[model samples]
Target chain A: MTAPFKGYLRADGRKGIRNVVAVAYLVECAHHVARQIVQKSDDMDVHLIGFPGCYPNDYAFKVMSAVTTHPNVGGVLLISLGCESFNRERLKSAIEASGRPCEVLVIQNSGGTLSTIQKGREAVERLKAIAAETPVVDMDVSELVIGTICGGSDGTSGITANPAVGRAFDWFGAQGAACVFEETGELVGCETIMASRAITPELGAALEACVQKAEAYYTVMGYGSFAPGNAEGGLTTQEEKSMGAYSKSGAAPICGILQPGDIPPTGGLYLLDVVPDGEPRFGFPNISDNAEIVELIACGSHVTLFTTGRGSVVGSAISPVIKVCANPDTYRKLSEDMDIDAGKIMEGRATLDAVGQEIIDSVLATAAGQRTKSEAMGHQEFILTYKAFDPLGPACLPLKRA
Target chain B: MPEALILLHPTDNVLVCRETIAPGTVATIDGEAVTITQPIEVGHKVARVDLRPGDKILKYGAPIGSMTKDTPRGGHVHMHNMQSDYIPSHTRNASGGAA
Candidate 1:
């Protein structure tokens, strides 16, 4: 008795909610060329995404590969400056082997800026035609991977948007869909309670240790996880904020901990440990909300649940972000940018369960190709920064076969 | 209807201004009309009673930060006169800062 949702089927037997052609710039140098190609194409499915770093990084390589191979991407066009550190050949081969059409245009080799833009535009047009030929298939909710993140947080974020997302997460997990939540740095005080929900004893310890690592890293930076604006917004302590933010994970048993590029082995609840594996090489784990979203997409999320009290307006390159507004006033002011109004819980207009159901409905609708506010407004924010990670500990992925 | 500025706990000496309070505006709390001496931005807090320096700034029934200078009753409480107790945040340090 449920309505059927339609999805695009990729050649690798994966289902995609959105069939998008990803135009990627290998480094910051080629960003303009990539942008010009997307702009000239004027296609809704053509999205622009890339790394801005001139230096090569393992994390960047992994993220780029994961994004290009994401189910949502129907094709990929790599814009290289010819001298950048990103492995363009390997990336092209990976996308090609995945049965998606891929093209590489080195700016230096393709004459100069004007000539390269012409060639890139031609390549994109060709890819667009090929991307249109991908097959459409019926998809079920069970095959979906959803990620949750909170930004521009205020006191209401935990009380409203966070819990509402938790409700949706619970529903998704019950339906056998994988739900992921990250930012161990933000979950400092609630680690003990969170670890208790781990499905296995080893996963529980790994959960605790990840939070400890975030605490240590933040301390070295001479700051607590708490921000000044958070204090101004009625949050008293770092742990208190953590307690509020942690609610977005819902009450599901933790399945395993995944790093930035590590995909979930099976469908269930997963925790992403975004902090670097060794000493902090990058200045901060996530410089902004878009960076975390990029990591979630790299982990193969089809869509993202973004909760905010201060009102963040960002959509992803490969995945659609559903914005849940936490504050009633903010929702009224920025309703154009938000998808769901969670402030109803505080105003006594709606119950948490009702809001949760609303989020679940939104997810299903979005999976069936509903455009979120950010997506409608064309907020394709993307960012990838340098990070080091030791592989997930054995305890982190208990489901992995020996 | 305008939302009420709630005091999360009875032990808390300060209350959050859930909505913006303009300069010279009067707000009623517990049926008492308290006149605002300065503007208090939404999400910021106001002292329910006069407090000396070092008194814990409470919201949600917990110590959020500490008062740097004496704050009068119904006065705006923010960064210029408040400081975090857990870790002191630095701004524009000339030396030993990020290069």
Candidate 2:
């Protein structure tokens, strides 16, 4: 029998792998002050994360609130530029009502940048001391929500790291943990194969529709999902790349389709429809890997499994990311950034199942609070671009209990 | 080890190099020794037989691209000699100047 792991339980009834106090700046003007506070706090758990947009966006507000109240965040310190459009009072109230400590430091009212930094530092120190006392409870694998993403992909990505993640996804799903795989734009060619793996016909249709939305969005953006570097790395077409990327979803039947902020109703496989609904208002669905990581965190993923063939080093603000290297040569060059070597598959040394088990073990270890390579290296890469998403249609959430 | 190069699909006329092959390296296919004249990177491909221009470069049993110039037996195949037959890619103007 596996030993039960201890997890930090938040007031919102969610479990987190780490307890962190987030210092968030409301706009770009207050960003420097927030960074200073986090730096002065000298606490690894005290992290700086913020939105740079001065223009108010409802999606940004929702994501910020969700992150502030996330299970991983033990407390929050909001920094505002005083003239920004974000409603700091409501944000503070939401954090306070969640039973977590929160403080707002307005640069204009707090005597400018230096003074505000001093005050913000004091607030963070106090929050850290309080958060240090939060209790940890016993948790099981079934309660874990894991998200998977592939970046810096090459020809070997699908054959190795992706399929390995798929194997882990299957194991996690079987163990009752919710698993999410994203980048519908990357899943263009595998639509039929992906739909066939859905648990129900309705879910199958939803999966197809999400892919269609991604294809339409990218088409308007004037590019196939295929990238030039992808060709340089030996990937030929969009569909071929899709086949490789789709392998990360594992072989489990997709139980539901989720938009950017929609949380999964239960433990099962979910396809995150990252494309915005209707006409593409946002320039691109996801500007980069970090954007997708933010969306996964908003959907309640406690940890993320990132697969790469060309190599990527990124960790999110609210969750830890486990990097799986797919290319043997790239792994040699970036060994420190990677958590697992699925390249053994290419070397003819390890089978896909063996690497898959390794990924599952890594997930359990990460959930038990083991810091991933990216997390330990202080790689808190976060990005939130502008995108419009209509509420999920009824067909998208057929599995949810009404 | 199966071979220095393996055809991933039956219809493929090109074979992916399983390991690095230097210029003048001799490799056997179907029990025949074929001498290479150009170095090929691992994961890159080489024409299995003489190929004419406009012929599809098949790998993994699919058309990866089309040969821009005629390639000889055991010749290295890459961007310098092959081009994508799908949507033509360009650096300055990808979508015909549509921003």
Candidate 3:
């Protein structure tokens, strides 16, 4: 078992790896003001996040509520372009209910852009002050919620960094931590194998159905999640990439399925079904890596493990992302940006077990307040786009012992 | 020292290049010496045996894609010779932008 670390205790009794004051814009028109507030604050802990849609969306509202109340979040400052349709009042109420300091500034009522930005900055300072007053408490691995995602993937990702992350996930899950692995669209061909690892037969069927939804959604969109960077880095097909991405889930028996804003009921392995439930209306399930990270944060992931072969340099707004480089060449090129080099396994300098242990150590250290490379370089990238998802079915979340 | 190629699974018909291999670089495959015919970058695959069009290309002991063209042993097995059984992979040429 891992030793307990000093974690920020939230009002709801959840523990956070980081204490962040989020500046959220209800609409795109207010995004500039929110950005200015965060930029002027000169505090890395104050991050910029928002839904850029003018129309109301249940999915967006749910994700925003979950994120604002996330364990990692200490407080929230809302920026609203007064006439937009986003329910800023309801969002503020949700934050207040979570006992976090929350303030809303309307662009129109607050005298427009310059004034809103000024007020937003002041609100951020107050939130940050309130966040700093959060009590520090000893938190265990069982209290942590960790997420894993792969970006800029290549063929090397499967054999090295990805499987290494899987091993780490297995370890963390065994230790009673909620370990989530996502990108159902990427799990196209491995549905059978993935389902076989589910704890119950009913949950297994749900797993297969979710992957089918992802396949159907991607088919309608006329493109799988496979990208040019993936091919350029030697990944040939979406299924091949799926097989690679699937390895990040490890061999842990998946306890349940979770949608974007659904928190896992207990600590164990979880498969986050990121694809929308209905016929494909939105362009892609997740626009970019950060979108998935945001969803993971919304689901209460305290820290996220990011594996890459071609390499990506993105972190999240509230949670810190630990980049595990798969290919030795990519690691050498982007060493400064990576947290763990699982590529060392490919180079014969380290074994998968060694690299996996290194990843766990890094997670423990990160939870203990060590700054990740992305965090140090100030890469708190966040994005929340419009999407629709139905509530999970009964079988989606099998009862797991807490 | 790192080997030129690494076989991921016993049933896999493709061996992944451990490093950027140059033409004429010799590698042992299935206990037989085969010389690389083209420059294969790390993470890319090379044919373990002669492959014909429509043959399922196995990697990590499962079919990842199928061969669209014949490839000799030690020849590169990638986008040029293989195609996905499900979705067609998009590149910069098709999307007209970096992905």
**Which candidate tops TM-score?**
3
Q: How much lDDT does candidate 3 score?
A: 0.91
Mind giving the per-residue lDDT tens digits that candidate 2 earns over A63-160? 78878887888999999999999899999998999889999999999999899999998898888888887789999998888999988887678778
DockQ of all predictions against the true structure, Cα-based:
0.21, 0.23, 0.77
**Ten residues in sequence with the least summed lDDT for candidate 3 chain A:** A393-402
TM-score, candidate number 2 = 0.89
Each model's TM-score for chain A is 0.98, 0.97, 0.98
Better of 1 and 3 by TM-score: 3
Question: What tens-digit string does per-residue lDDT give for candidate 3 at A1-402?
Answer: 567999888888888988999999999999899999999999988899999999889999999999999999999999998999999999999999998999999999999889888888888888888999999999998999999999999989999999999999999999999999999999998899899998889999999999999988998888899989999888999999999999999888899999998888999999999999887777899999999999998899999999999989998889999999999999999999999998888888999899999999999999999999999999989889989998788888887443
Any runs in candidate 2 off by more than 4 Å, and if so which? B2-17, B23-39, B45-99
TM-score of chain B of each: 0.79, 0.82, 0.92
Question: Taking the tens digit of each residue's C-alpha lDDT, what string does model 1 give over B1-99?
Answer: 544455657887777666667887888665688888787655556788887788877654555568888988787666667766544443334246578
lDDT for each residue of candidate 1 in A35-58, tens digit (9 for 90 to 100): 998888888789999988888788
Candidate 1 error regions (>4 Å): A224-228, B1-99
Ranking according to TM-score, highest score first: 3, 2, 1
Arrange candidates by DockQ, descending. 3, 2, 1
